[model samples]
Target: MSQVVLITGASSGIGKSIAEFLVTKGFTVYGTSRNPKQQEVNGVHFLALDVTKPETIATAMEQVLEKEARVDVLINNAGKGITGPLEEIPEEELRSIFETNYFGPLRVIKAVLPTMRKQGSGLIINVTSIAGYMGLPYRSAYSATKGALGLTTEALRMELKEFNIKLTNVAPGDFATNIAAGRYHAPLKQDSPYAANYGKSLALMDEHVDHGEDPQKMGEAVFAIINEKEPAVHYKVGAYMQKISVFLKGVLPSKVYERLLLNHYKL
Candidate 1:
């Protein structure tokens, strides 16, 4: 039997690409959106799932299990983007992003573990970001959320290994997606102290996303990971430079790396 795969945030962008690609590979794919307009999309079933909502997560899981009996793979891809000076971003917004990006995935994982444990084999992929590897100017909250998720996955992987279940983190760099349109931006206050630098950083982030790699590449990378018999706990998909930045951080002195980031962002 073909594996049953479930992906969150699959209405568009990277999630959509992954869902469509997996369908071609003969997996019974279920893609989810907060508001699904159709029951099927490009050979993938559409389910309504809001990661922040536990009831919706449970409902979606139940729907999938009722039809497929088991979900062989779970992709935690539903996440929101937030960018602003940490000092100026509202506390509520920070909490909201954490709910969507960090706690949301954890909630879904908890819901699925019982089913996977019964099956005795399964894989969970948490979609993180290259930004998670380091702090970025004006994107601190976004970085923190991903970083937290990544670290949690590291711990969970060991805990789940005994059950023959696998967990991994896939950190993608900026992709040409609609993420920018959905990202929350603190107002560019005319009198705010961070106006100038924050504005520059925000514009640069948008520019990167506008010209970033195709989402299909991410889809392909994920497909390969699913096929692997023994996958690593952490996988990074991005341009050479973006991947190298993480390596550089490890080798370079802390202050030097900080200066490099400052120069790159033109701060």
Candidate 2:
């Protein structure tokens, strides 16, 4: 029997790519979206799911369980981005971003735990970003959510060790996706001091995204991990510079690393 895999945020981009790629390899893939009706792919079963909505997440998972009997892998790929200077961003807006990016995944993970615990083995992969490690100018809220998810994943790995449920956190560098366009940009006041720098930083950020690796590569990385008997706890998906930066983050001095980070954006 094929391993049953369920992925959230399957409507498009990396999520859709992963769903398609895995199904082609003979895995039973259930790809979810907020509106599954219009997000159909060739080989994925469309399930309506809005990660932020508890009822919808429960319903989607139930629909999958009824057919598949077991979900061997669960990939939490659904996320949204928010960008702005920390000072200008409202607390409420930041909370909403966390709702979608961090808490959203946590809810789904919690929902799946009971089922996975019963089965005695499972794999969980939460998609995060490089920004999780470094605070990006004009993208502080986005960074916070991802950073929170990263640490959550780390904790889950330790907690689930004895259960035979493997947890992996993937920190992907910019990929060619509509995430940038979908991201919320703070409504800057006409005379705000951040106006000029915001524009420059936003442009630089977009440049990294526009020039990021193809989303299909991310699917390949997922495939490699799924086939593993015991995958590593963390993965970095991007070009050499991006992956190397994850390494340099650990060995470089705190001040030196901070310098490289600021220099990357010419801050």
Candidate 3:
């Protein structure tokens, strides 16, 4: 039988692209959404899964396990986006994003571990973001969530190595998708101290998403990582500069790197 692959948040965007691509490659793909409009699409089976809800996560996994008997790969692609000045961002919203972006992935991983350990061979890929490498202005919440997930992936990789279960994080830069529409943006207050800089930064961020690289490129990247004999703990996919920014932060003086970010956002 083909490798059984389960992907969360597969109704659209990067998750959907990966799901469709894997189906074409002959993997038995089960793509999930909080509310799937159909039973299947492009040869990928649709399941109802909302990462933020533990009950839904459990139900989805149970359904997949019942049918497949073994899951070869688990893709934690479900996440939410939030942007605003750190001070202006509501505490509840900050926690909400973490629920979907960080804790949700952890829950899914826990749900699948037993089966993966039993099989003695499995791969778990967490879809993170390039922003996770550095905190972007007005996007601190999003960056923090992704950054936390990335770090968690690194730790989990080593802990699960002896079980023959491989784990890795794939951090993608901006990709053309509907993410901007779904992201939570703190209302731009005209009288707020951060009004000018925050407004400009928010516009720039949306424009970047509007013109981001094709989502299919991300699909291809994930496919390549899945085929690897021994994949690295982290993989980045995006524009050259976006990937290079991560490296620059490592080598440049802290103040110098901070200046570069300020200039980039024109803050």
Candidate 4:
């Protein structure tokens, strides 16, 4: 039987590409976004889902179950980027980021667990970032959310092992995605002490993202993971990211890593 995969944030970028790739590989692909009209892809079914909304998640899952009766893979890829100094970020904005990045996946996992448990096999892939493993200037809020996701994936992997559910976390470095161009925003409060530094950080981030890896590569990596009989717990995509991971593991100390990041971003 063709495996069924549901991917969130499929309107664009990595998620959209992943959906397209899966369909090409003979899998039943269901792509989700906040607005179904926003999805222009033809082969996959686009479902309306707002990860931050509980009712929306529940309803989408019900509809998927009704049609397919089983979901073999769940890709938690719906997320936004928040760039700015940690202190300059408002509490509300931080909460909002976590809502979409962290709790959003949790909600979807909860909704899908029952079905996966009943089936005795499933794979959950969380699209995190290299930022989740190491901190970078001006991305504390964003990185923290991914950090939470990393930990969540670890715990879920252990707890769900007996049930034959595989959990994998994909940590892509910078990717050329609409995330950098379309939805990124600094926190609303204008009076923070780190405002100047925040501005500088955003400028640097913009420059880096412009030259980042292709989103399609990320999609290919995700497809490979989903098709694997034994998936790894963590994967680092992107050329620069793989090198950085090696450096972090072999040479850089925590303090040295912090200094390197700060100097790179001029923070």
Candidate 5:
């Protein structure tokens, strides 16, 4: 029997690519979106899901389980980007970003755990960004959200070990995706305090993303992770420089690493 895979935010970009690729690999794939009514892909099934809402999530999980009976793989790929000076970000907007980026995936995991435990095995893949490891200059909130998820995922991995369920964090450096399209920008003008620096940092971020790795490549990386009997807790998928930056952040002195990051962003 083929494994049943459930991927969130699969209507477009990396999520869509992963769902479509897995379908070709013989997994029964169920892809979710806030509005999946027209998210029809040749080999992927669409399910309506709004990760921000508890009711929508519960309803969507029910719909999937009701149809598939068992879901073996769950990929939490739904996220939005928020970029700007942390000082300028509204409190509510920061909270909202956390709602979708950090807590959203956890809610879905909670809904699926009972069934996964009963089944004796399951796999969870949380898609996080490399910026989470080394904070980005103008994207502090976005970085914070991903960092929170990464830490939470680590704890969950340890807790779920004896239960036969496995979880891993897939940290992508920069992937050509629609993530930048939905980015939240801080309100600022030429005379505003943070405008100049924020604009420069934001522009560099945009350039980095525009030249980032391919979204389709993530499908192969994730596919390999799923097939591993014992996968690492953290996996980095991006350009060699980006991956090296993450490594150097751990090895270099705090001030040295800070200087390096600032220089990279031309700050």
Candidate 6:
């Protein structure tokens, strides 16, 4: 029987690519997006989903379960990026980022766990970022969210092992995704300050994302992991920065690592 895989944030980027690849591999894929427009991708089904909304998740899962009795894989790929200096970011904006990037996956996982546990075998893939390991200048809010995800993935892996459910956290370096191009709302505050520096930081972030790795490549990496017999708890996918970030986190002192990131970002 073809395995059933459900991927969130499937309208574009890594999620879309993963869904496409899985379909080609003969898996029955249900891709989720906030937009209801039917995508004409071969061998995949698109379902309207908003990860931040529990009703959307419950409804989408019901649709998938109605079609396919079992869900073999759940890819928690729905996330957003909030780029700006930590001090400049408003509390509300920061909370929104956490709501989507962190809690969003949590919601989906809760919704899918019953089916997965009942089936006795399943894989949960969380698409995190290298920023999760180390903080970057001008991306404090984004980094915080991913960092929380990284830790959450680790804990989930340990907690879910006895249930025969696998949790894999994928930390990809900068990828060519619409996430960077997506609009970010600034944190609202009573007094406005650090506006000029925030603008400069956003410009720098844009330049970095424009030259990042391809999302399709990241998708390929994800496919490989899902097919493995003994999948790792964490998978780092990227060329330069992904490897370097892990190395620095392992060997360098905290202050030195911070300096290196500051210099790399030219902040």
TM-score of each: 0.99, 0.96, 0.99, 0.93, 0.97, 0.93
lDDT per residue for candidate 1 within 156-264, as digits (tens), equals 9999999999999999998999999999999999799998998888889999999999999989999999999998989999788999999999999999999999999
lDDT of 2 at 160: 95
RMSD of each: 0.6, 1.4, 0.6, 2.1, 1.0, 2.3
After TM-score superposition, what is the CA distance of residue 201 in candidate 6 from its true location, in Å?
3.1
Residue 154 displacement (Å), model 3: 0.6
Tell me which of candidates 3 and 4 scores higher on TM-score: 3
Model 1 scores what on Cα lDDT?
0.94
TM-score, model 2 to reference: 0.96
Model 5, span 55-88: residue lDDT tens: 9889888888888888799999999899888887
Please write out the lDDT profile of model 3 over residues 171-266, one tens digit for every residue: 999999999999999999999999999999999999999999999998899899999999998899999999999999999999999999999999
User: Runs in model 6 with CA error above 4 Å?
Assistant: 185-197
RMSD of 4: 2.1
Worst 10 residues of 1 by lDDT: 194-203
Which residue pairs clash within candidate 1?
none
lDDT of candidates 1 onward, in order: 0.94, 0.88, 0.94, 0.85, 0.89, 0.83
lDDT of 2 by residue, 123-215 (tens): 999999888877778888888888999998988899999999999988889898888888888876668898877777888878988998999
For residue 140, give model 6's deviation from the true position in Å. Answer: 1.2
lDDT of 4 at 203: 77
Candidate with better lDDT, 4 vs 5: 5
Q: List, in order, the clash count of every candidate structure.
A: 0, 0, 0, 0, 0, 0
Tell me the spans in candidate 5 whose CA falls farther than 4 Å from its real position. Answer: none
